[model samples]
Target chain A: MRIPLVASLAWQDYRNDAWLSACSVLALVAVIAPLLVLFGLKFGLVSSLTERLETDPATREIIPLGGGRFSSAFIEQLGQRPDVAFAIPRTRQIAATAQVGTLVLEMLPTAPGDPLLGGLPVPQGLEQIVLSHTAAEKLAARPGDWLETRFARQVAGRVEARDTRLQVLAVLPLEAFARDGLFAGLGLLEAAEDYRDGRAVLALGWDGEAAGVGEQRVYPAFRLYARGLNDVEPLRVFFARQNMLVSTQALSIAQVQSLSRNLSIVFWIIAGLALAGAFAAIFAGALAAVARKRRELSVLRLLGFSTGALLLFVVLQALYSAGFAAVFSAGLYGLAEAGLNQLFVQVPGEHASHLLAHHYGLALVAVLGVSAVAAACGGWRVARIQASEGIRDV
Target chain B: MLNLSAVHKSRGAGSQRYSLVIPALHLRAGEQVAIVGPSGCGKSTLLDLLALVLAPDQVGRFEFNQQDIAGLWRADQQSTLARLRSQHLGYVLQTGGLLGFLDVRGNIALSRQLLGLKDDGSVARLADQLEISDQLGKKPSALSVGQRQRVSCARALAHAPQLVLADEPTASLDPLNAERVMHALLAQAREHRAACVIATHDEPLARASGLQVRRIHCRRDSDGGVTATLGEAG
Candidate 1:
């Protein structure tokens, strides 16, 4: 007979044993629970880190220069490299204040079509300003409404022009729009710089740009979206060899992935220990069942039951316990994962990213592997039975 | 028929060897014999050897009905002995031989099952004859000594074995329970036309049963070997 069939019978006998049945079930659960938790943590960390890498351009770049001027000059050069798929130079600056009437808003400048600003709405023209939902509400500004962004320049010992305005282009999505919300295109930053300089600072300037202003230079950053994360390193090296100060935050990605990997290992280890306990319980249960049926087993031996038959019977019992436990654990783990996900919200557009982000492949492997081991342990005693002793005391 | 010639049994070896020597023994079909002896006479050891439950240290020409049983491999011997014992030999122990996990019926059914006897009526009829029909659902622990003994007798005789071995089957029972157990056992043995071997010091049972009685006496020989002398016991 198949060992699984025999294990099923043994499991039935174990169930009749009552106390042993409970113990075996407990062992199975112990093994499965930790594996599920570890799997969840691994997926969570990996997803969070990948989100940071792919969504934030600053983190993806190999080099970020200091200043409002971004050199699109290297964009054409970097794009020609065989290893690089897409590289786009972007003007990024931190504006301390965007004063609209009595309201002062935080200005974060970003690229117009960056993948990182996925959920936020960006405008196509200079007349439009994409206000954060909070900023829109604070300024009482509508999509078509015009808003002024004033900047004060400190040149020499004097304050220059302090006022400027940009049309409120569009209102961003209310959900997570304020979470590091970006104002795309360099026009807004340019307008703010113009307000500081008093004299118009547009296009390239040679002399008398501002009282304290020196020669113009470009402060630049670029987003390099390669086909794979492995491609990120070669590009980093290429940029470094060119005498450029390159900084790729791929280490952050590695840190997240590593944390996820470590957490999974820890979870599986803990889960494995619990599973071992469960397996022991199942083994003990099988032993007790055999002990209870000592006379029956003896009788079977007398009836020409080969030791193989007895082994089959025991194996069947274990399979039965494990099979049931597998189904139960899977269902329970699913329900728990769903409930946990519902209870914890990471972000709104967090779903539609990559293929491997939230998958519980590791967890599945852990649960099944542990369960199989546990079941095998339960059947060990049945296979090792001494025919003489099993049959009778004589 | 069973035969044993120059059967030498011992535990351990060399200076520690505790040997029991039974020169020759034979039992024809339908002959009930009792092995009566003092304590530590190796009566149980002889029974164990005869039952083929344990192998002796040495034996010359050991056979059952002309079939040589000596020198059979342990694995083959175990299966062969199990079949022979299940079908032809019954053992009745003193401390409630019926398993505690099994009810009276299960205990009885177990023997028939072992013997590959599937007839429920035969089992039911035997249980009725043993006077344990009403207590078939009760475990050995739940039954009185006399009832438990009767259940054991039922199980032992369920498949109608050729020889029934009783190892002090009544030693733990009261006089009445012991007599009842013996009477039930002997009656079943007779019904099956089987030989009964009762290894016990119960003289009352020995005398009243009217079965052939053989006494085994153990004494240390000059060489320090324990010699078991077998003879007719009054």
Candidate 2:
């Protein structure tokens, strides 16, 4: 039989059994909507997490311990490691203080392209410094403002100090730093190191010229960064092989990814169960329809409709239900996505929740495939109906 | 044209079996034939066999349009027969058997749709002739028994089949409605030059239709088996 005739006949059957058709379609929609919502939630949450991880360079940052006086040569050597993107020496002072007149704050040395600096401009010259937003606010300083700070040292149980002046290059956003801290270039850090070791330098506002002019300045530790998150573990392993301790956010990132994957599996199981129920409902409905339409099917057969035509009619009816369900489910998915996105913004100051296009396509395929298989089962039964059965009614 | 010679069909096996034997039957274009018999006499069985819906155990010759088609009951041949039936045969059941989902017009056009043929005004013309044109849009449930029977007659001839088979088409109708339905059926069959076969237990109505008659005689033996024999044509 022609496809149009089969389609028209199936449509007529659907219209004739409006209540049954509506119930079947509603049941399918109930099954498909939740599955789609779960899929959308999975995609939205996972993509949001992944996007955050991708944008945050600190996830790849590595800190190596007990480096014991890292010279420039050692820093450059660490940078030469293929997995290492860049390396810079950091002082172990942890809480050295910087004073801009009456405003004293914790200070640390920073390097170019430090992940913690996060887009804040790096200090370039010997006299330049970068301040956290809070520090900048307390000091009332902006870029091109000069600030003065004192470094104190304990020498044989007596305290001695030296003062240095530096120009602020930029102010970083508060989230860029773990706390409100003042940041300066290596020159200022070296000066602070010298002062802490009881060394004096006339050029850096000390009593006299430094006596250790020819000595090599070595850092107590180094801050390392990898090219990507996947390289962080390798860099840590490399440091561990050298009897050095390293720290990174790799463990936390891994935990997040694992949690997301496990949640995805759980959601999939739920969706799978719902889909199976949907299939059962559709299959049962189709079977019941076939039983009820047996007389009509026999009449068609008696009218010379081939078995294939009868089967097509049955399948077309089911496909119509599935098609309607898919459309309804998609609409529900879209509304849910929009509502959830509005209800819960994933990232601060950004809209990060959404269902991907490919995910919707996959859901469509899955639902339609289930519908077709379920409908075909009913069609098989219809195909077995004999034309002689109509005569029995007579 | 239709012809059957020495066809044999049976149900069950051995002592509990019932069987039918047709020695010879032939019909030409525009011929209207009735096979009248009591209940359990294998009249419906003979109709089903002629419609190619039932397989006979043996047949010397079963020809339609001069084509020898006896014993064509294999799976492949059954499919071929189905195609031929779709193209060349029409049927009206005792209860109208119209699809409940379709209206009268759709029921009439269904066979043509199944055969992949376009309606060339045959359905409308037949509906007009059958006086069911006003009810073409009504479903079978809305029509009276007699109106339904007339509509069934219109549907049976709407596809312009070469042969029409109707099983007790007026068995449930009042005498007047039965007469009207039979007259319309035979007139349409004659107009289309298609042969008609009707199976019924209404002897007087069958004879008064001015068609050749074939009687089926069946008797149960002492062993619980029935033997049915087709009487000579009259």
- TM-scores of the candidates are 0.61, 0.85
Candidate achieving the largest lDDT: 2
Off by over 4 Å in 2: A38-57, A68-99, A102-114, A122-128, A148-167, A182-220, A226-235, A331-354, B14-16, B65-71, B76-78
**Which 10 successive residues of model 1 chain B have the least lDDT summed?**
B73-82
Worst 10 residues of 2 chain A by lDDT: A346-355
Give the Å error, residue B36, model 2.
1.8
Pairs clashing in candidate 2?
none
Give the per-residue Cα lDDT of candidate 1 at A181. Answer: 38
lDDT of 1 at A151: 59
lDDT tens digits, residues A194-298, model 2?
Answer: 667667755566653456658776678876779776787777777789787878888977876787889889987898788778878778877887788888888
Report iRMS values in order. 5.6, 1.6
Backbone clashes in candidate 1 total 14
Which ranges of candidate 1 are over 4 A from the true structure? A1-223, A227-247, A264-394, B12-18, B28-31, B64-68, B73-89, B112-119, B159-162, B190-195, B203-210, B223-225, B232-234
- How many backbone clashes can be found in candidate 2? 0
* lDDT string, candidate 1, A319-390, tens digits: 555656656666676676666666664775452122242344544454455545554555456444543354
